[model samples]
Target chain A: MTDSVFLDSIQPLFQDIHAHFTSQPDLNPQAAWDELVQSGFLRLLLPESAEGAGLSVAEALPVLMAAGYWALPLPYVETALLYAALPDALADAIDGNLALAVGTCGPGEPAQPLRLGLHCLDALVTAKDGGITVAPVSGDVEQGWRLQGEVTPLSQVLDIRLLGTAAECLQLAGAMQRVLELTVDYANTRQQFGRPIGKYQALQQQISVMTGHCHSAVMAAQLAAGGMQRSNTGLSLDHHRVAAACGMIKAACQPVVSTAHAVHGAIGVTEEYELHHYTRRLLAGRLAGGSESRWFEQVGQACLDSGASVFDFTLANLS
Target chain B: MIPWPQRQTLPASAEALRSEVRAFLVAHPPAAAADVRARSWMGFDAAFSQALGERGWVGLTLPTQYGGGGGSAFDRYVILEELLAAGAPVSAHWIADRQSAPLLLRFGSDSQRRELLPRICAGELYFCIGMSEPGAGSDLASVSTRAVPNDQGWLLNGSKLWTTNADRCHYMIALARTSGQHGDRQQGLSQLLVDLSLPGITIRPIRDLAGDAHFNEVFFDNVQLPHDALIGAEGDGWQQVTAELAFERSGPERILSAMALLECWCDWLRLCEADTGDQRTLGELVSRLAVLRSLSLSITAQLAQGQSPVIPAALVKDLGTTFEQDIPAMLADQIGRRGGEHGRVELMRTLAYTSIIAPTYSLRGGTREILRGLIARGMGLR
Candidate 1:
């Protein structure tokens, strides 16, 4: 699908959903999820052939940004990934029957799989022994299903599939960008010492650093999106580059987001304010698709293999 | 259909230029004995530069009438990447080939171009930057150097610090205030192409922490030059200098200065494959290095498109230098205890040199603080 048309369709839906999400005095995750699913966002990443938008990553960036702008509480990103990775039949089922629970489950000690609720139809699990298993999930929203022995963040026993971590990273990055923008604007207009705090060189420098993070994150997301779009066959180096870039985004963004709160001072942490929601989302995003240190190690390993000069392969890649 | 992020398409002519530069570097690989490859941007293998000039590689972007290749900026950028990547010792001709010729081509008069362009393109003439003062640093507007208008053109009397290759250059493009106070920071400044050999001018080498006399303190006292020496109209120095800096700050030189050292380190890492811990350390370093290279090349592509991404360029330089400096420190931390091991001494010396020279990385084109200031301004913080 063309980017413009996709953007046009999703942007207003995002705005309406975001407005409804933020107007509440506090986060209502269940209500927000109902609104998102009702608005068809939960199916945005699913293939059109499966009765969904099948929107590309680039087309989904605006929705992510909007979600970040309003500090949406629903696990839209995780659900989007789940939908993208669902088997054709499952995707069709979810599209036709919108009330089903979809979650990623991976192997672990004592194997605690992801549990959305007892209402989940099926859980996707990838086992330690290189086996894929689909286990029926039977529970209600009140009592979460125990698919595996133990309940870990993303580990579960029902079913499993490969999902795009880049989308998750991009969603977090976009949210961070919004947080930074709001913080910088607040710093500029909000006065301290009888002047806007941004006038202080130290504050200005901090904001500048934050801006760099935002810029790098956006660039990294774009490069990753480009890779996903253009390359059918991925190289180890591609994984290294994309993973490293995402790692950098996290490393640069996580602290910057927290600092944005600090820069905002007391007003930011209050439950009434939207800042905490954004920060929470940022933290959750960091945990998704591996931690910053893991990606850093991956990038470091790639660089070491090509010898210590990153420029060698990078330059050749550019040429 | 969605348009791709504008891919950089190399011009057909650029392909030819790249081949020509590659052939030239192969034929005249700057004298290998002086450890010239290690010098990177500072290495001034005069013979190699002269050979490039002879082949019209120098001043490749200047107008054809002015004895240049009359090529586009992309053409010059292609050549520059190849030369710097190869660690060509073109330092003697670096400023001239990179900035001076272009500056003169844009602002120099017919006679000025005729007299200087041919020699510059021929690689016989070299130019040194006379922008930084002892106190000024990146604050070009704060330059106290003055040139009083006199009957014999202008009586130039001011000193320039960190003037690279001042002792060897034929001329220096000194940014001097012609008619303004420090408060009028950027106003009334003018660029004068002063002859280095002229009377009353003294070039004293200042050895850096690396024990290399790559920079100098050039004292211009009552230096006399004809009216033709003025690069542009009077009081146009601020604009002229800004343009020159854009050239200085953008390019592979800012990132690749320590590339050869990195190559050496990689070789050493491969030779010591049995050392698992050392291998792991090498792995981490390489990853950061790769990300930095991509960042640098992306900026280069921006530059090739004639986009004056000064802030982005500064960002690249700032990050690039930090990475370059980190290499030696990281390597040192890994190998400090293994100093007595075979081949460790050579690596140790190279590491030591890189460590000492690393501080200048930020200082050379612009300091980190100055770059951040620029970045902040670009981000609308100032």
Candidate 2:
């Protein structure tokens, strides 16, 4: 009888993401990606008249959360955000033949050549020089000393990166939740000392700590999402608050991943076990947009730079 | 099973209500200084509470028939969040506005609502929780307080320890043993509205480490009560108390317990020589607070939908208290490493006060150990 319209609406997508986890050796998420795009999952954050879901990031968070929960291997979040940030890339992104990769550049950082759209990626967008530019994925570019792919110059990718970062946080939260659930189930079933290991108070405490980390990660993701919800509010989106939330989520990945594995012990590393499906994604997600430390430092720098009263600044900036 | 938190948004109309709260808080400033702001909700000021009542801010969510504003949860959330952020002394009417009025509206007899709710909404009447006892800590069902049925009313005989504001509150919603003895985890329990002014009831303050007596030992020795004092059906205290915690655990109060200090500490950081490293620490805390507030708001939205979200509520309290407790340590380290001028010294004094009460933040509502267990049970680990 509970009114879960949001979860109820996204249940099919959640099942679709789960259905992608097959007995296949490789996690081929291409099929699921096409299905989601066809279902307009990629347009969730866009405005209503644009054939999008017309929902804010806050409302779209459950979809992102589900993507991670099933360890869906597709870059749906990045694509959706790319479309939201650069509607010009919508056609290519929707085609599924060309995936979008978002790259971030700091002040005065030179344009570096890299493999952004690694798998079936034909287009690359980078934020630099205070402008957003879209470029063709220069053919297999070089790495270090080897010429592997084309090096394309790009600029103004910060907003897209922010979107991608928030997406990563959502996915990471979902994966961590799955890990906690799986580990707890393992503890209940795995026998030790003539009983389920979960019966021990010490282990229970550790699992509890892992649950806390997972919960915090989820909360941080929600915050990041809420910050992005300012899209159509007529109120200028406070990037500082959104960025800090992203930073918190990125930072939380460390503890969440570590505690999850700790609770699982040696079995957590085994390939056959589904735990790594999420842990591996969580780790890669942490590194993709930006590491936790980078974001934390940025948050700190923003606070210091924002003048006078930090309290007033925080109140005004937060969603 | 703990239902997945129903994701909802702050409707545009509700978001518009923030300015009203901001305006109200600005007009009515706190009477205390920075040092006492560290106490957060524990700082009591009946005058301030009554001022809010006059504006119909108190019991903002209760029905208009009971002198309430007949508002949504968001209206109440905005007021409470603003008050909490300012470190306003809300203790005088905190219990009544937060839990008591809601409890009575849900389970209290119709007569009880007509008689006491109006005064409560006016902030003239206050109530305290009577759940914990001398022997029962987190195992609340172990309460030994007994209410024997008599010709006049139930004669209450027992004591409730750690009863917050028992010394000052007008009444207490006590959980007592009605038909079962000790060791009955939750059976045969009942919730009774025992008036503290009645004979056979004693309120003794127990000063904490910070030299404050927010918690006290409430003794009810054969306390006489009228038939109307029983809140709802007898022997349903366990279910009722559990319902009460849904309101208790999830709120801005859980996280705001140490927020005033955090805000003050943020201001204190500016006074320092201001290193990027220290600024980043402030940034870390800010992000944590902002994110936690979002989750808290989500829980509030859940309550508006009439759902019990106990597991998530417990989870929020556990994580919230952890963050609340950590604020002082982080500030103390920063202050210890880089000494500043008067603002830093003031922050230090506030830290001294905040640090002492920090232990109780996680302990008071429900200890971390107990809350974690609840989370574990929600995860099917138990």
Best by TM-score: 2
What's model 1's lDDT at A161? 19
* Candidates, DockQ: 0.25, 0.46
Give the per-residue lDDT digits (tens) of candidate 2, residues B138-253: 98988899998888889999999988899999999999998877777799999999889998888889998888889999888778998888888889999998988989887988
Docking class of 1: acceptable
Backbone N/Cα/C clashes per model: 20, 14
**TM-scores, all models, native as reference:** 0.83, 0.88
Using alpha carbons, what is the TM-score of model 2? 0.88
Per-residue lDDT, model 2, residue A277, is 71
Native interface contacts kept by each candidate, as a fraction: 0.25, 0.56
Best-fitting candidate, measured by lDDT?
Answer: 2
lDDT of 2 at B140: 91
Local error of candidate 2 at A160, Å? 4.7
- Deviating ranges (above 4 Å) for candidate 2: A1-23, A26-60, A89-96, A104-118, A127-160, A226-238, A307-312, B339-343
Q: Tell me the tens digit of each residue's lDDT in model 1 across B1-382.
A: 0011222445677756777777887887754522346577888778888888888788987877778887776677778877876778879899998889878877888888899998998888999989899878877788988888888888888899989999888889998888978679988999998989899999999987777888899997888877778888999998887766667775767767766666666667667752555645544445445445445556657655566566776766776677677777776777664766644555656666777777888788788888877776765564
